[model samples]
Every structure is written in C-alpha cells, then in structure tokens.
Target: MNFEIVTELSHLERVCEQARKVPAVMLDTEFVRTRTLYPRLGLIQLYDGETLSLIDPIKLDDMSPLWALLTDESVIKVLHACSEDLEVFHHYSGVMPTPMVDTQIMAAFLGHGLSTGFAALVDEYLQVSLDKGEARTDWCARPLSDKQLEYAAADVFYLWPLYHLLAERVADAGWNEAVNQECNLLVSKRGKTPDPEKAYLDIKNAWQLRPQQLAVLKKLASWRLREARRRDLALNFVVKELHLWKMARFDIRSLDKMVDEGFDRFEVERHGSRLLRMVSELDTLPEEHYPEAIVRLVDMPGYKQMVKEIKDQTNAVAEQLGVVPEFVGSKKQIHQVLKWAWVNGRNPEKMPDLLSGWRKAYVEDRVLPLLK
Candidate 1:
C-alpha cells in the first residue's frame, strides 16, 4: 500500500530512468471525461514490481522523460483493459507505449473472455477485491484524497503479479505471439477520429432517411462533430443526435418547426438558423449530388445467410480453440469483414479486420473461404 507521489521533474526523470531498467512495468492512468472529447489526465500509476509510484501530471509540465519511457521498445508496458488509457496517452503525449502487453488480451486468450474488468481479473488471479467507489471522482481536482490515490495505486499494484501469471499461462498455451500482435493492433486502432463527412454513418436509424434527407443529416452530423472537437464540448452539448436527425428528416424550415420536432429550445435558439441555412442551401444541390440512400446490411440480399454461415464457422473455430467466441470475432468484426468483402464503393484500401493480425490464423482458413 506504500507508494511515492512523484510531483517533481527530477523525481519523474529518476523514476523513468529506473523503470527503463526493468523488462516490464505495470502502468495505468486515472482521468476524467464526463463531457469533453478528450480525457483530462489526473494521475499516472507505474509499478516496476518494486517501486509503486503515483506520478501527478498536474504538478509537472515537461513529461518528456515519461513519454520516452512509454515509447521504449525494450520495456514492455503492461496494462489491464487499456483502451481508454491508450486514448489518454496518445492524445496527451502524441505517442503510445510499445512492446505492449494488455493483461486483458492475455486473459482473453487464456479463456477468461473479453471485456473482463481489471478488478475481476485481480480477484481471480490475485485473490484480492478492489474498491471501485472512486470510479466517478473528479480526477482533475487538486489535493486528491488519499482514498482516491489509494484506489488509483491499486490499479497498477495488482497488475504486476497478474501480468506474471497471465503471461506465463499465455506463453505456456503457445499464444504469446498472438497476444503480442493483438496488443499491437489495439495500439494501432486507438485515437482514430472519423472524418466529419463520414460522421453521419454512425447515427442510429440514419439508413431510414431518403437520399436528400441523408444529405442534410450528413451536413448536420459533420457540423456537430466539427463544433464538438473545436470547442472540446460533447456532441450532445453542441446539438443532440435526435436534433440532427429530426432537423434533416422532415425538412423542418422554421425555428418553430424545429422546436416542434423535439429540438431542445436552447439548441434551436442557438443553432436553428445555421441548421436551417444548411438545409436550405442544399435545395440548390443537383439531384446527383445528394448522398445515396443508405442500404442496411440486413436489407441486402444474402446478408443474413452470409452472416449466419460466418458466425457458425467462427463458433466452431472458437470451440476447437477452447476460447470465447467473442475473442474469436464479435458481431461488429463480422460486419467489418462482410462489408470489406462487399467493397460496394467503400474504402478500397481497408482490409477485412478478420483477415488481419492475430485473427487471420483463426479466420482465414476456417471461415473466410466461405466468402469465396
């Protein structure tokens, strides 16, 4: 339970220097992201199996030493469920840790199932229960409570032992290389912000819109995301998704119509005119310029049969490998592979995710031949 609070540059430099000597170090971050697009990093916990240090980024301005340590290839950075931690590090430092080992990935490969919580892993491997009460605390606030510090420290403290256990188990199972590649792929996928033009694709029920209506929805979705990023505000704070879809759906012209269509009164007042202008300007667009009506995969010919065949084969592979089916392939990933197979005027450069990285060995021989 004893840990050092590193708040000075010299202390951080010394800590990183010492950590560089280790073969691997446990790492974790505590941040707040209630409303903003980017996480506000609060504290960093690093444990080299000997020195458990809580480095306060709020106190230090120059984090070059820590950043260098993160990018060091000789030292593996071990983390549990590190998706957001990867985002926080990539956004804040502009670099991600290398030679990474995600304990969650190892656990999944070891048949614990994907999306396992860190506390759950710790309890199973280390026989210790973690207090998750501080999960919603304001991490950006100064003078973080001892309870908060203790909670954050616990994130990395148990990781050291758990990494050892899981790594050995994964290696003994002969899935170490797959685990490493999965970790690498995980790092590569972090921090990919979609372009504004394609932002509308993420809207739910967007496919129901007509071609011209889809065009208007695209414009609003683009503007909302652009404004959100520019102002660091949440997308809903700028304009609710319902507002965007409604503003585009029925082709509301007047501000009153907007409010009638369930647009928040404040949003209508603040953005109604701009939104109406975007829709009105589209009136001049040639019919050919409008986006094509979205074609849902379920509505496509042979989509259900293709999905069923692939899902069945994937399940067989997972059963043979003695792993969770989710670890083999999730529904989203199946859709990615199917969409790539279709190549119906989408990005030509994008490869099927199932045909790449660790997934390829499991999928290419067993399942993808069906697509052919």
Candidate 2:
C-alpha cells in the first residue's frame, strides 16, 4: 500500500527509473473530455510491483520521463480495458505503450466474456470490490483529495496480480499467439486519425438517403470533423448528428430553414452558411461522383436468408468452441463479410476480421461455407 504522490519533474524521473527495473508495470490514466475534442489528462497512475506512484499530470510540467517508460518495450505495460487509456497516452506522448497486455482482452479470450468492465473483472477474478465513487470526479481540478488519490491508486494496485492471473489462463488455454495478436492490433489502432470521408457512414438512418444526399452527408460530415478538431470542441456541440441527417434528407434553401428544422441557434449562426454551401456544391457533382446507396441486407431481396444462415453457422461454431458468437464474429462484421462476398461475386479474398487470423479457424470455416 506504500505509494508516492509525484508532483515534481525530478520525482517523476526517479519513479520512472525505478519502474524500468520492473518486468511489467500497471498503468492507468484519469482524464476529462466533457467539453473538449481531445481528452485532457489529469492523472497517471503506475504500479511497478513494489511502489504505487500517483503522478499528477496537471502539476508535472514535463511528462517525458513517464512517456519514455510507457513507450519502453523492455517493460510490459499492463492495463484493463485499455482503449481510452491508450488514447490518453497518445494525447500526451503521441504514441501508444508497446508490448502491452490488456486484461480485458485476455479475459475475453479465456471465456470470461466480451467487453467486460474493469471493476467487474476485478470483482469476478479477485473477489475484490472497487469503490467507483470518484468515477466522475473533475480530474483536471487542482488539489486532489486523499480519497481521490486512494481511488486512483486502487486502479493500478490490482492490475499486477490480475495480469498474471489472466496470463496464466491464456497460457493454459494455449491462446497466447491469438491474444498477443489481438493486443498488438489494439495498441496499433490507438491514436489513429479516422478518415473524415468515411464519417458519413456512421450517421443513423443514412441508408435512407439517395445517392446525391449521401454525397452531401459525406461532405457535411467531413466538414464537421475538421471543425471539431480545429476548434477542440465536441462533434455534437458543433453540429448534432440529427441535424446532419435532417439536412441530408431535406432541401433547406437558407439558414432560416435550417433553424426551423431544430438546428441550434448558435451553431446555425456560426456554421450554417458553410454547411449550406457544402450542400450546394454537391449539386454540381457528376453522376459517377455520387456515393453508392447503402443497401441494408434485410432490404436486399433473399439476402436476409443469407444473413440468418451465416449467423446460425457462426453461432453453432462459437458454441462448439465454448465462446460467444459475437466474439467469433459480431453481427456488423457478419454483414460486412456478406457485403464483401456479394460485391466481389462471392470471392473470399477480402474477408472481414472474423474471417481472418485466429478467428478464421473458429468462424470462417463454418460461415464461409454458408456464404458459398
């Protein structure tokens, strides 16, 4: 339970030096992103088997020492449900921790369940309950309370033992290669800048729009993404998805029309003209330039039966392997596989993730046959 509250640069360097000697270090980050496009780091917690260090990112002027330790491949970095924590690290160091082991990923591979929360895993595996009272604390605020520090320390404290337990389970299951592949993919994907042009695909009810409208949606979504990042504001705060969908579906001639359609007054006043201009430019798009219609599988005649068959085969194979069907292939991934199959004349060259790597052995063998 002995820990240090590190607020100075010199102390952080000394702690990192000590941490380098450890084989593995448990890592966690406390950050806030309520009003910003990027997560604002507030605290970083590290437990290196012996010392639990609570490093205050808010007070520490430079995090280079800690960043070096995190990016060091010699020492394995351990985390639970690491996606967001990885993002926090990327925001600070512009790179993800290497040779990382995510207990959550290991838990899923070991039949613990998919996307299990950290607290739930701790309770289930170690029979230890974690206090989540400080879950919503303002991490960027100055002078963190003793209770907050204790809660933060607890996040990394159990991680060391949990990592060993999960590692043992993965080894027993003989899935070390598969688990390592997944962890590597997780770290590589962290801090990746998403394609703005593809942002339109995430809008709900987007499939209902025509090809021309889809083009407009793509442009509007791209604009929104750039604006959000440039202004460091939430995407929804800049312009809600609902408004985007409405704009794509309807013909709004002027800014006045946009306001009537439930667009925020300030947003309409600020960026309404640009949105309209983007939509207007889409009118000049060539016929071949328009985006393809997103045809839902259910709407495609006879494809519904194909989807069901694939799901049944996937589920049967998953059950036989003693794993969840979604773990083998999620519904979205199944749909993607089917879409690729249909588009490519039933060729299996570009199969989805479920049909690749270790998943192929469990899922593709059964599902691919159904697709044929």
Candidate 3:
C-alpha cells in the first residue's frame, strides 16, 4: 500500500504533520514486553488513505509531538481492539487519544452481537483475510523483513477501509453515541494501578490459606508488586510465583539450597539474601500477631447458595438479552455480593455499582427479584 517507514524523529515529524491535515487516522501498534511491566512501543503504524506511515519508536527520541496529534480534540483516531494500545500510549506520553473510534466496539453496538476479531471483520467486510502468522513475531527484532512490513501495514491499511464500513453501519444503526461512550471509557487511564491490599485476592491459593498464611501472602504479594514497579521488570521474573507462595510456608534456612537447585536464580543473584532475611523474619513472628483478615467464606451462611443463585440468574438474564454473561456481572462480583451479605448484608440498591452497566437493567428489573 506504499507505506513509508519512519524510524527517526524527523520522519515522525512529517507523519505528525500529515496526521494534523487528515480528518481521521487509522492506527495500530506492535510491541514486545514479555520481559517487562510496560509494553515496548516497537512499531506505530498509521494510515489516512493518502499516506501510510510506519513509525519505529525504537530509533526515535521523543514521540510527544505524535502524542499531541493523537490527543488533539479536532482530529479523530481510529483503531480496532485499542484498549491495550491506549494504556501503552498513555503510560509513555501522559496523554490519551480523544474523540476516538474503535471499530470492534462499533461493530458490537451496531447489533453485530459479537466482538469481531480484526481479521474476521476484514474478511467479512472487505473480503480479504489478513495473515496473522507474523502476529507473535518478536517486534523488537532488527532488520524488518518485507513480509513483516506488509503484515504490519495490513493492520492499519485495511483498518481505514474497515472503519469506513463500521462507521457507516454505526450511524445507520443509530449506535454512534453508544460506540463513542465505549471508546471514551477505553481511552481513560484511571484503573491501571493495582491496589496492593486487594492484590492478595488474585492469588489462586488465597482461599486455601489461613489468616496467618494470608498475612504472609499479602506481604509477599505487595513486596513483589512494589519490586516489579521499581525494577521495571516483569513480576514473574523478580521471583518465581512458586517460590513466593512456598516462602509463606517454608523458612529461609533452606533458601540457599533451593537457590542452588535453580529456584529463582534472578532473585538469588539480585536480592536473594534480602528475600531470605524477610522470610526468616516472617517465620519468627507469632501466628497470632499476624493480621487475621482471611475470612473463611465457605462457612458463611447463604454464601454458597447465593453464589449459585447469582450465577444462574446472571446467565439466564444474559441469555435473554443475547449478551455474554460477563457483560452482566463477573464471577468476582458474585463473590463480592456474597461478601457484602456477610458484612453489611444485602441491599439490592448497591448491586448496580458492584456490576457492569449491562447488569444494571437486569439486576434492577430481573435478578434482584430472584434474590429476594
């Protein structure tokens, strides 16, 4: 499609200039981040029908000018499945694109009744199937191949045409406002920070642990989270999850031997002794002195029954509405509902905020009736 690859800051400026002139730009990004908390912005592909610009951030110094064009209220940015990219751009540039359109979201709102994958959407609308075999290829690799360039170009190149179709469909179906609302929510950056106090709940074995065990688990989890942020490396790389959980149960006296057996060599090489000291300190603490916060939910009355009923009712409502059950209320919300009952008791009024918007209509009109 005659895509111009822009690897330097100078080329980025030209691309930004063209973007300022275009009414809207179709965009996509390719990144590598398996080793870090942040996705490495390797490639930024944009097309405005007349021009296709491939921006390589690896060689560019600052992308703030491009960020300005994106966040500029006058120009619109179009994307498909843009949630992750929104987060990445916001993290790097401190600004998120506004007045954006997400083709995938638009498709669903237009009563396509499914979140269509980009390739599937392209095939359905444009009658062309994108080659995604290169999707997982390490974008950080040097010397971009022609095949890779074509594949990358296809991402945004077809997107311009695809968005044209989706935008028309959304307008015809009178779903433009709904689609825009969804896009605005996606572009916001408020919910990215993980709350440390609630972090332990994400651990798989959280329910199995006693209060004392949970205290240690919480401490370990918070420590890992803080360390991952501090080092800018992936959490799993800091300390193997198995070793972290096991540390709650096992003392650190045998940590050296475990390290020798290839247990968290990264942690061992970097902060192994400090971790050992932390574990040793935890081991010496009295069980009664630890936070007794892990409440045994199974023993609570009506907990299991309420959970079963909530799930059944949520699925039934989703079926009736022809939407995914998760769109109604997630399983975690059901668990929280049960927890709420355990504490302040059930007030159907509070359930709406606890669930997704799709559930408000159902919970208010249907599911709450079943609860009573």
Candidate 4:
C-alpha cells in the first residue's frame, strides 16, 4: 500500500535514477486493450527492493529514462508471464527490456508448470494470496481507486523474493542462461511484423483451398490485415477471418449474393466490394504468382509415425536435460520442427526456433538427427 505515483518526467527520472543502482528490478505494466490492435498503456510498476513506484504512463511525458533503465545490461528486468508486458514495452518504447527473467518461464524450467499463473506461484512459494479484483479495470482511466493502486503495487511487491527463490533453483539446475535465452527469443518475436500478404496461410482450413481459390484468399486476407492495421481495429473486427475464407471459397459475384450468404451488412458495405474487386484482379495474374498450395502437416504420409518418433526422442532429450519436455520442445515446437523439416525442407535458409538457442544446445545433436 506504500508506493510513489510518478506523474512528472522529473519524478520518473528520480525513480529510474535510484532504480539503476540496484542489481535487478521487478517490472510490470497495466494496459487496457479492448478491441484495438495495440494495448493502450496506462500504468507501469517498478520495484527495486527499496522503492515501489507506480509510474503513471498516462501522465508521464517522457519514458526515455524508463527505457534506459529497462535496457540497462547490468540491471536485470524481472516479470511474470511477460509476453504481454513485452508487447507493451515493445509497442511504446520500440525496444524490449533487457536481460529479462519471465518468472513464469523460470518456473516452467524448474518444473512448477509450463504456464503458471503469478498468483498461483506466489501462493505456492510465499504462502501469500494476491488480490486480483482490479484485473479487469480500465487502466487508462483517470483517478485510479485505492483498490486499483493496491492491486497494481501488489504485482511487483513480491516479485523480487519470488525471483530470488526461482533464480536459486535455476542456478542450481544450471538453467540461468537457458531462461535468459528463452526470454530473449520471446523479445525477438515482437520485433517482427506480420506480413499481410501471407496472412491467409495462418487462417484455419486454408490448406483446403486450391491455387486459384488460394489466390483469392490471399487477396482477401491481405486486405483484411491492412484494413485492421489502418483502422487500429482487431483483425476480426474489420472482417472475420472465416468470412474471408468463405468469400474466397464461394466467389460470390454481387452485393445481393454476398448479403444473401449472410455476411454482415456493415462489413459487406464497407469492405465487400473492395475485397471482391481485389479478388477479380487475381484473374489477370499469371499462374506463378499464386502461392503454392499449403501443405498440412497432419495429412503428410508417415506423419503419425514421424511425430511419435520425434515425441519419443524429445522426451528422451528432455529427460536428459532435467526439465519439462514442453520447455525444451513443446507440442507446437515439435510441429514447427516437422513443418520446417518437411514443408520447408527445401528452404535451408530458415530454421525453426526449437533448433536454435538453448533448445538447440540440448536437442540439436540428439533430436536434429532424428529429423534428418
């Protein structure tokens, strides 16, 4: 309940000035994300084991000091389940916190669970329960209540102690560098933008479409992503992904047909014609421009056998590594490895993340051979 609310640049500087001297800092952010493509930051919390400061992102004009402290190599920035926090930091600062330790990832390596909730870990480790009543409050709104501020401060209050406990286990297990590498890999993902042109490849059931239909899907998908970004709306808010797929599949030729098919009129009126027009232009394109048909990993012959072999080998390697198999190579990561080896086999220019970094350190000699 005791903390400083930093609203001015000078106050933020003062806090960051003191925080930089500490070897490590606990960090968290409160943001409101309703339907927009980006999270609107509201508050930032920092604990240097001495001062608990709630930096008012809404009132603070300059966050350079915060960025400097965050990127400071000497000071470890710690958080729990930092995927979203990483997004917030990357969005506003255009850079991620450095030498970050996601306590959630840390716990996963220590065998607590793959995705442990912060409160659950706190209770399990510290025997203290957290109040999460303000979890859904509008963080961007002014005049935050005492309860809200308390909730915010509670986020970073116990992080240092929690980090201390987890770090010791991680160090004993000799996974400190692994945790650090995983956090860095997570940060690297935020730096890349999703290519609108390839958006259709990610849509469900996209593999069912033929090359010509896939071309239409590609145009529709591209438009949807571009429009979503342009309007700052959630992807589905612009045009539902299913609708894009359906529109491509049916090739509905007119407004009446599009409406008759039950597409939302607002969307039909706003984007239907443009989408249809884009698809029509596809007819003029040469055959080579169409994306190659998507290859479904599940449909490949020997897919089941390959997966079983890989899973068995992964479990073996995971056992040797003394961590959860999912931590080394999750179900998703296994699929990525399969896809990389089979679907993109000819493209040696790329490699799956599972075969990179600390994961590679463990599984490359052991598992990469199995893929070959």
TM-score for each candidate, following the candidate numbering:
0.95, 0.92, 0.82, 0.95
Ranking of all candidate structures by their TM-score, best first: 1, 4, 2, 3
lDDT by residue (1-372, candidate 4, tens digit) is 589999999999999999999899999999999899889999999999999999998887888999999889999999999889988998799888888889998998877668889999999999999988899999999999999999999999988799999999999998888888888888888667799988999898999988988999988888888887888898988988888888878887788888887789888989878877887788898999888988788999888988888788778877876668777777788898888888776366677767888777767786677767
What is candidate 1's lDDT per residue for 104-204, written digit by digit as tens?
Answer: 99998888879899999888888999999999999989999999999999999899989999988998999988998889888988857679999999998
TM-score of 3: 0.82
Q: Which ten residues in a row have the lowest lDDT in candidate 1?
A: 343-352
The order of the candidates by lDDT, greatest first, is 1, 4, 2, 3
Give the lowest summed-lDDT range of ten residues in model 4.
Answer: 345-354
Q: Provide the lDDT at 139 for model 3.
A: 86
- Of candidate 3, the 10-residue stretch with the lowest lDDT total is 350-359
Highest lDDT: which candidate?
1
Question: What lDDT score is found at residue 330 in candidate 3?
Answer: 69
Summed backbone clashes in each candidate are 0, 0, 0, 0
* Residue 230 lDDT in candidate 1: 91
In model 2, where is the ten-residue run with the lowest total lDDT? 343-352
* Local accuracy by lDDT, each model: 0.89, 0.86, 0.75, 0.87
Residue runs of model 4 more than 4 Å from their true location after superposition? 320-322, 346-349
**Pairwise lDDT winner, candidates 1 and 4:** 1
